[model samples]
Target: MRQDEVEIIEREICYQGFYRLERLRLRHRLFAGGMGPPIVREVIEKGDVAAVLLYDPLRDEVVMIEQFRIGARDDARGPWLLEIVAGLIEAGETPAQVARREALEEAGCTVLDLLPISSFYTSPAKTSQRTHLFLGRVDSANAGGIHGLADEGEDIRVVRLPAAEALLLAQQGKTDSAWPLLALFWFAGQREAVRARWSLAGEAPPASA
Candidate 1:
């Protein structure tokens, strides 16, 4: 059935803070071509985010960060999660802008070239959070260090490792999150071609192809 088939009976803000929780009561068409019973659900309203997997062609390295994530507090592996540079899209900023800003703030690197990888919803069933992913070429020579906004209570440790090793770790389930893992798998497939394209002797990397 189409979107119009779903009828929203009620929606309200259940909670509001750093993120929002909205309660929804709705129903939609069933397989039998009849309206289904109304169901109630709550969704987290975290606006879209932009994430970048930093790759340095010159060093064949990947730039990542380890930070404490409250959401992963109960994970068997603990809450300090390994992830790439990422940030929420702020007002009046584009996805690419957010990617660049996050790279500098989280990894202390200036992104030279950026390639669009994909966009995905983090958990459609529970939240309205979508993430735009990108592959960014950077100079990883001095990428490792502690970086984060002091006021945001962020304590991020920058990690630079061989791309192959990072990808292997991602493949081995070292990262418990989806965005970084997805970025690594995408890079693994496009590494050679992208490297060749970026080597064409230009100061700025080409736009997303």
Candidate 2:
């Protein structure tokens, strides 16, 4: 029912690579009565992530990224995923810092302003990874290009599309990810207000590429 109700009995690192896999033995208080039987669960501990939707308010467009996702290899649609800019939160780094860094590294754009969208668990049942999402204001004119740190084995492609079209992709499951879809829908409901505010400031960059 709550954090207090769930008890973490024991945890150990079963494996560690770029991320970590933890095997835990635990039990929780049942809603019907007392504590349930002890159970074993494996959790992926990849640390937290920060995801941002790069929005060029003036051009009414969104900057997206496309990259190969190993997890999606079994999907008939292929593993190359279209998603918002994101990266893990490193030690001594804030969510905002991660967002800005991932934006530049993945999409080649700098965030001018960041609007917090939400924070949620990526896979509550299987992973301890939580993601903080934001709507980032940017000038997307030069955003399109091959980016990502080569030393890290990254080969990313930046994409720019009308915000509406991007949302349509989410509705059709084309984007194939949660954070981007969530950001798009959130932006949809708040678009008019954001655009109105930006319009008054009269800050629209050169047309998005």
Candidate 3:
């Protein structure tokens, strides 16, 4: 296993002749439990991912997308959700490149400058997903419309709202998704700087600090 890289070297797994789905002999290790030899576990490493939750300072709004999510199905949070614009990093794509591409694909806006917010895992124990969240300043006015790649069965509706209103919704738990909620509430605390950042878009007047 390389510390700098995610690659891991698995020794082998000798199952007890148990046949199951995929019938691949069910790989395991020589030892199990607290007192045993150091064995290799199923190591599914993750790659770095970049996502942007855009805020259009000029329109005093944030750019979000509404879509149906299976994970939140049959829940009070609502299966359909307003989430920060995001996508997985494609091959040979940088975080910045993913951010700019998703902005146009999901919201039809061009990112003027991408402001990083945080780098954290969407979940660690469950999956090896790492997310680098960004706050992109874009033109929000006339930005809302239907967007998304149809080939992937993605039916996305763009939503732009006043930053204050989004913050209020986040506080009230009206909006869904963790990244957007975090970004909104974070901006809530840094309203002055966020407002200034939005002002750079110049698509609308600067929001009051």
The candidate that achieves the highest lDDT relative to the unseen native structure: 1
lDDT (tens digit, per residue) of candidate 1 on 113-180:
89999999988999988999999999888888899999999899999988889988988888778889
lDDT of 2 by residue, 156-192 (tens): 9999998778888988878778888889989889986
Question: TM-score for each prediction?
Answer: 0.92, 0.92, 0.75
Backbone clashes (count) for model 3: 2
Q: Write down the TM-score for model 3.
A: 0.75
Q: State the lDDT of candidate 3 residue by residue for 1-209, as single tens digits.
A: 22332233343433323211111112223234223233344423445667787876655777888998988898875788988888888789988899899999988989998878888887664345778888888877778778999998889998878777778889887886888887777778776777665564535565343
Lowest lDDT 10-residue stretch of candidate 1: 200-209
Residue 65, candidate 2: Cα error in Å is 0.5
Off by over 4 Å in 1: 200-209
Kindly indicate the candidate among 1 and 2 with the higher lDDT: 1
Regions of candidate 2 where Cα sits further than 4 Å from its true position: 200-209
In candidate 3, stretches whose alpha carbon ends up further than 4 angstroms from where it belongs are: 1-47, 197-209
User: What order do candidates take by lDDT, descending?
Assistant: 1, 2, 3
Ranking by TM-score: 1, 2, 3
lDDT of 1: 0.90
